[model samples]
Structure formats: C-alpha cells, structure tokens
Target: MRSHHLLPLLLLCILFLAQCTKEEDTSPAENLMQEASKISYTYPALSTEPMQKASTLTAAEWNDLANWQLWTPQLKLGAGRLVQEKWHFALQHRYTVVLTDSLHKRITDARITLETSQGTLLDESRTDNNGVSYLFLTAPTKPEDLRLKIVYADQVFYIGDLNPQNGRIEKQLNIQRNVSPVMDILFVANTSLATADKLVYLQKELKEIINKTKSQSDSTLHIRLGSIFYGLHAGNSVIRTHPFILQPEPTLLTFTKPYTTVTHSPETIDLALEEAIYRQAWAKNASSRLLFLLLDTPFLQDPGTITRLSSLSREAARQGIRIIPVSMGSMNLSGELLLRSLAIRTNGTYIFVTHPEEGLSNPLSTISTYTDEPLNNLMLRLLVKYSKLN
Candidate 1:
C-alpha cells in the first residue's frame, strides 16, 4: 500500500516538473518573438489593385506622372567612402488627373525611376489618372557613394537631401564613383507580373545610368529589406522604410518587419541586431542619451518569437536601456491586444498603424514637435525622471 501511494505521487510530481520545464525553456525565445512582432506588422486590408492605363501625351509635351511626397532621406553614420551594401527602398505616390474632356481616354503610362549618384533606374508602375504609385530599387555596387533621384517625364525629382554639384546627372555619378564602402541594393518584386516587369526595367535603366556615371568597385547586398513572412519579393522601398533605424547608437532606431521570406536569412538578422547593439552601446557611453526602440506591432505575434525578445528586453532594462515600441498594426482587435500586451510588458509606447501612408508620415510630425521644445526644459525633465528611477 505504501509503495502504491508513493508511485502515484512521484508520477504526478514528474508531470508537473516536466510542464514547468517546457515553459521555462520556451520563455526566452517567446519574448524575442513578441518584441520582434511589436517591431513589425502586416495589413492586407491596405492592399488595392494597381492602376494600369495609357498616358495622354504629345511627343513634345512632358508629363510628371509619379508622386514625390513618399520619399525619405537615407543617412549613414560611416565617414570615409561608405557603401550601403544592400539596402531596400520604397517610393510611393498617388497619380491622378482631371479629365479635360467628357469620356476622356488617355494612356497615362506611368513609371517611376530611381536616380542615384551612380546612375538612374526605372521601376514598377501603376498607370492611371489618380491612384497610388509605388517604386522599388536595388543600387548597383559600382558607385561607392551616390544620391538616389526620382525621375518622372522630362523633369528629374530630388527625393534625397543632396543637390547636384555639376550637372544633376554628372554630380550624382561623381558621388557614386567616389564613395568607398560600395552600396548594392536588393529588390523585392511585388506579386503582379506588371510589378516584376517594372522592377526589371528599373534595373536595366540603373545599369545604363551606372555605366554612364563612373565605374564599378564592390558588390552591394542582395537585398536591403524583405517581408517578414512571405509571398513578397524583396524590394528597395521596403528597406528604405526606416532609414534612421540603421544609424549608430544614441540615435539608432529599431524595426521589426512583417512577412518573413526566403531572402531574409539568419545572416541579415544577425547583422541588423549587431548594428543596433553597437549604436546603443555608443550612445550609452558617449552622448549619455537614452536609446529609443521603434517596433512594428503585427510582426510580434508568434509565441515562440516573443519569448526570445522578452529575455532581451529584460537584459536591456537591467543595463538601464530604454525601449520604446511603436505599434504599427493594421490588424483586427485580437492582433492589437497581443501587440499591446507586449508593449506594456516592455514598458514601451504602442501606436496602432491604421493606414500605412498615415503612419509613415506621423513620425515626422512627432519628431518635429519634440524638436521645437526648449532643450533646457527637456533636459531638466529627463534628469528629474532619471533621478526618480535611481
């Protein structure tokens, strides 16, 4: 009788122990995934059909079919000849026009081109009177440093900050040739054949432009940005989404992309993580400024991933690091709840991304407002808060 009772008790204890061990083992990885999800997200609802129509243009009359507001400046922390080995960029604009006559039928063949210091390239298109226009580019390795320019019709649009020193095209070429660490761009093509054609065309144009600018040196990255999950080809636009995120610490921004695809490998993750940590370390020791983490929400759902990120957050907190999670989720309530929980747990801020276009522009507003405040007042407030934390 005694043996029988002990056997049952021992089995029950073993079962409980096994369960606890499983949870403990997954906890770390789960946290990582959660944090990553909070850093990235997906919103299928934002998807709409691409526009395809002919342009109404006389041979002599030029039309500016692409929109330019969506472009953002991509800056780097490196000094000497720097190259963005492989970066992705996304350029979005809406193209629409009023009908000059009743029942107007005009082919608005709209296309987007990327102009770098090295050269000019064309990309995917949606031709319509008024609709969203998106373009992607992968820079060539030849030009060490360059400025990316957007061209539509006869006029060239300047998206980045640099101005053309010589002739616009010549100045751009010079920059691309002179830069040291070369840059190569990876492109994620969209699902449509039209989109792929657009990207291919852009690459071809870029090759010609590069050849005209200067000479090739190093090979850049296979891709700069990619979907966290799948079904999307890596593209320049995706990589360019968070240009500031790649900067060195004291000013580094973090991002989690939704939709993982084959192009996104362990190597890329490791590189990005290392860069971020290095920046954080620099800021902590040098400027004494707190590091801010910018996380996208929808991407942080899988429990396994969350566990891993949670452990990292704990570690960061232990070292007096501050993480700010910017929730950019366009999912339903369930997804929102999961993201919010992670943000709250990490002691970070969460902002739901209802519209990609809106969310992308909102950051600028926030930054601008903060910049206008008096520095002394801001410093005093921060110092007071730090004292309280101590």
Candidate 2:
C-alpha cells in the first residue's frame, strides 16, 4: 500500500515538472508571436494604389493611392548630375503641364521635348495622366538658353517667361513641385537599447544625405539636419527649439542599458506630430514633406490606439506629411503590420532593419526578413522613397 501511494505521487511530480519545462522552453518566442498575432490585421479599406504623382515621383512611391492629397501633378523631384561616366539624379521636374480638352480627357499620346536656347532638342518624352516628365541635368558645359516645348497634334506650347499656354491646352502650366520636398527633413528616433547601434548607423547615413544635398551643384536631401530622440532612455527629451533645424549630432548615439521598452505608440507619435512637427509653417506647404521614424514600435498596440493612429495618419497625408518608418530589433507581426499600415495610410514607406535567425522573408514582407546588408538596401530605398529618385 505504501509503495502504491508513493508511486502515484512520484508520477504526478514528474508530470508537473515536464509541463514546467515546456512552458520555459517556449515563453520568450511565444510571447513575441502572440503580440505579433494581435496586430496581424487586414485593413481592406486602406488604399494600395500608387499615390497621385506630382511633376516628380520616385520609382518607389509608397503604395497609398487614395484619401491623401499629393502635390498637384508630379511623380519625382530633385536634380541629377553627370559625374564621371555615370549620370546620377533624384529627378525633379523642371516644368510640368497637363493636356486636356474641354471634355476633361487626358492627352496620353502627346509628345513633350526639352530644347537648348538655340533650338536644339535635348530630351523628348511622352505624357501619362500625371503629365510630362522633365528632369534637370548638370551637364559638363553649363549652356544657357535651355527651353521646353510641347506638341499635341497641331497645338504647340513653349515654356518660358514670355511663353503662354497653347490654345489647345486646358490649364495654365508652370513648373510646380510638391508642397513639402524631402530635401529638408526632420528625423524622430527611438532611443531604446536595440535601436542604439542602429541609430548610430542611421546617423552616419543621415550625414551622407546631408552632404549630397548641401552641394550647390547637387540638389536633394540638402537641408540643415535635426533629430529628436524619444523614449525612456532619452535624457529630458528636448524638442527642437527652431523647428527642424538642429545640427546633426556626429557621434553614434547609444542607449545600451537594455530595458525592452515600448516607445513608439500612437499617443507618442501623435504628440510628436502635434508639438515637434506640425508647429512648423512648412507642415502645410513644402515640395516634399517627409518624417523619418527610427524605432521598434511601428505604431499603436491596442485597438483603441490603432484607431487613433488611423486618424493621425490621414491628417498627415492631408498635410502631405509622409511618415516613413524604419524598425530595428526582433521583427514582430504587430509592429510590422502597424508600421506598414501607417506608411500606406500616409503614402509613405516602411523600412525593416531585420536580423535573420531563421533567415527568410515573410511572404507579406510585413514580417521580418533575413538580409545580408540591410542598411545598404535601406539606404537605396530611402533614396528612392525620400529623395523621389527614379
């Protein structure tokens, strides 16, 4: 009888111990997946169409095509230069015009050309609904008398100070760009532990953007640099005193005290937009207005918060403020989804600074992917997205 009782007790203890071991083995990753799952929502209402291109648009326009108001009619903006044998450019519009009849039909098959002052044609292209594409080129020889001409059937139009619109064209044409151009950008970053090293890498990259744009000869991302570090680790979080104009911090910023914090939430982001951002007059009008977010939190976590985030995103889009998010550390489903949602809603881009352990890309790309050099890809995308490069 004693042996039987003792055997049952022993087996029960063994079973409990096995259960504990299983839970211990799965806790960390399981928790991550659970959080990610909570945010794995499919928002069918969100627009996935390409944004209305202005006179200038990058090859990579963040996939939002509805709701927001993009600057009039450009796809890509900025400038290009011929350095050595290669011609590099961000592709800003020098002049733009929409061809339409009284019936409001877009002239899709029209021919557009740019010519030298001496009537020599330089570049000729066709038009889509958005308008004709005209890019500025920094040739080795800075020749004067560069002019533009448009021909639709028998109608002829010249773009210059003295030239007027062709009788066939419907609207008055001018060289119009975006309301807020990304040439001058404001960066907001999370100062969490996982983002510490990543922040350093980004700061270096930011310097590259600043240097490239600052050249009087070269144009794009050329603005006075500024950053606002947000999170628990940030010491007394200082908002910029003079709008988005802070001297670029040279040293790599590190907040190495690991405390797995959630700094990127809807409230925090909304506050940043209200105080740190929208206070500027340019918030309403610039050629390319862009906001770069470096963080682990893509957006809000809870449903209530996410709803608020949607409103904020729409407002940002209305103001032409594109919110580009770059996430660091372990990629979770929730963060990725929310981030992509924010970008799409605001007509922006989402950059994933993912580390590969299993080393594979999620089919949706909202989840993490294993990359050899994530930064290089990020930089290229940034150039294409923020610089509006073709």
Candidate 3:
C-alpha cells in the first residue's frame, strides 16, 4: 500500500515538473501572440479627408518612386481561379481585391457580386469604357466570408486577393517638390548615435553643393545646421543644445534631444521641432528639405522599449527619421519584437542587422536604401510630379 501511494505521488511530481519546464521554454513570441490576440485594432476617428489630404503622392508619383525604388507595393496574384481560402482581419479591418485580364483583349463589361461566408453582401459592376475598369473600397469587413464572381467576362481572369492591410493598390501620383541636393547636415556624432558615418558623409557631400548653388526650385538647399556633439552626457550639455541658438544662421531642421534622463519621458521640445522639418520634405509647394535622426536603441526612455513607442509614432508622422531601431544583438524574435514596437510607436520601419559593421553608415542611407530604394519610390515620384501639377 505504501509503495503504491509513493508511485502515484512521484508521477504527479514528474507531471508538474514537465508542465513547468514547457512553460519556461516558451518564448516571448508565444507571449506576444497571446497579448496580440487579447487586443483588437480600433480605427481612429480621423476623417477620410485627412487621410486623403495627408498623402500628396499620386499614382504617377508612386510609380516614379517605384522606378527609383523608394517604395514598392506588395503584390499577390492568385495561383489560378481562387476557389476559396480563409483570411483573418488586420487592424480589425477586412477587405478583398479582385483582378481580371481579358485573355489578351480589353475587358469591356463585367459585373461582380460579393458574398460572405454567411450570405450575399454586395452586387456591383463597371463597363470598360476603354480597356479596363476598377473600383476603390473604403469600408472594412470581416474575413474569408467574402467572395466575388464574374458575370460579364466569365473566363476573363483568376480572382486575386486585395487585402488593404497587406497591400496598397491606390493610384499614386508624384508630387513635384525639389529636394535640395545640397545642405548643411549637422553631424551629431554621439557614440550613442548609430548612423554617425552617414551623417558625416551627407555633411561632406551636401554642404559643398549647398555652398555652390541654390536648388533648382530656387529654395535655399540646406539639410541640417548647428553642431555634432560626441561624448558621454554630450546630449545634456547646453553648449550645443537648443534654445541656446534658435536663430536663422543655423536653421533648426531636426535635433536629437537628449536621451531620456528618466524613464518614459517624451522626446525633448527641440527634437519635436526638428521632426516638423522632416515631415515637410515632400510637402506640396514647399521646399524639399529634411532632418533625420539615428538613435542607438534600448535607451533609458522605456523598458523593453515598448512603453515609449506611442510618442515616437506621433513624432514619426511629423518628423522624417522614419524611426529605425538597430539592435546590437541578433535579429531574433525578441529583436524583431523590439523593432515592431518601434514601428508601432513611431510609424517608422525597422531593419535588423546584428553586427555594428553591417549597420547603415548614415541617415541618408536609411532613406536612400530603406525608404527610397523600396517600392514607395512610386509614391515619392508621384509627390514630386504632383508638386509640378500645383
């Protein structure tokens, strides 16, 4: 009897240990998914007008930028006739995209009916005037429950998925704003800053150009101004800090406010001012100039860097740095989480290159390589062209 009781107890202990070990082995990614599941994206109240007004780049601009590789849209063409598939909502918004080619002929007429998993939701159509017809959907919906059928051009083309969260298909035109080819780029060379070399490169190349001639748009072409402070506590020093010199000689485009002295503090006022300049770089009818930042990550601002990202996101909208977080560590799930956190917080993109040697050399490289080299080039071009339109 004693032996039998002991065996049961031993088994129970073993099971308990096994469960504990499994939980221990589970990674942060698992934990994050759990957290993400608990939360749902609620659309902000900002009107569609602002959203439309905010983007000045037209289809042509986007396409031109695409040519330059500034930004690219993510495209997904189905394997064949997309019979059926399941999809989840992103940002609590669900959408469908349909595309059809008339074999080789121009598709003149087509009607589409949308059905949800539950039942029919919408019936719509457009007759091709020239060669094609397209539609824009602004409302959000629930998942795979949606379907489309071709009534006119029955065997025209396969059904393609158009999930807005995954891709943007809007026709983008370029805004024609002349980005100054030359400027006085401030090289704030803090050991804490990551892209010091790139700043130095811009300073060297652009400064010369700004000195030689004005921008084609006839606006003064200066990218940055003031000093490049390098050293510990250099961020705190008043000598090169803002307010000390806010006048016109060295125009204040962007400034890296001192890193948070306390946990979770917002970026300094000076930094905020600089971001304003960055956002207007492609503003319609405005001189194209920018001020960017290259901050080293895991700073004192917030723990896990997650808590502090909200303020960063707003700043990103106004400022041009496109908040990129470079981890000194490997690009693992945790590192990616950090990057994602920054992206969420600042409306910026993330790049995970582990070694310092492999990091971007300067601020321009981030735009030139990451932002401009991508498909958004189309957006940029559209904006540039749009400026001319104005």
State which candidate has the highest lDDT.
2
CA shift of 201, model 2, Å: 1.8
Q: lDDT for model 2, please.
A: 0.42
Return the lDDT, model 3, position 75.
Answer: 10
* Candidate 2, run of 10 with poorest lDDT: 76-85
Residue 385 displacement in candidate 3 (angstroms): 13
Each candidate's number of clashing pairs is 72, 24, 59
Top candidate when judged by TM-score against the true structure: 2
Give the TM-score comparing model 3 with the true structure, all chains together: 0.34
Q: Which scores better on lDDT, 1 or 2?
A: 2
Cα lDDT of model 1 by residue, 1-390, tens digit: 000011334335544554566453433223222222222111111112211221110001001111011111111211100112211111111112111112233212222333455455433232222212222333322223433443334334344433333212221111111111211111212222212322333333333323322222123211111111112336321222223222123212122233334322221121232233332322222111133322232343344444444444434332323333332222333333333333322222233222222122222111111111111222222222222210
Instruction: Tell me the tens digit of each residue's lDDT in model 3 across 92-166.
Output: 121223233423232322334344545444433332211222222224454354444444423432233433444
lDDT by residue (tens digit), candidate 2, 126-198: 4432332322333422334655576655568776432324212234333232222334465666666556655
Give the Cα lDDT of each candidate. Answer: 0.25, 0.42, 0.29
Task: Score candidate 2 by TM-score against the native.
Answer: 0.46
Q: On TM-score, who's better, 1 or 2?
A: 2
Off by over 4 Å in 1: 1-275, 278-280, 284-297, 329-342, 353-390
Q: Is candidate 1 or candidate 3 better by TM-score?
A: 3
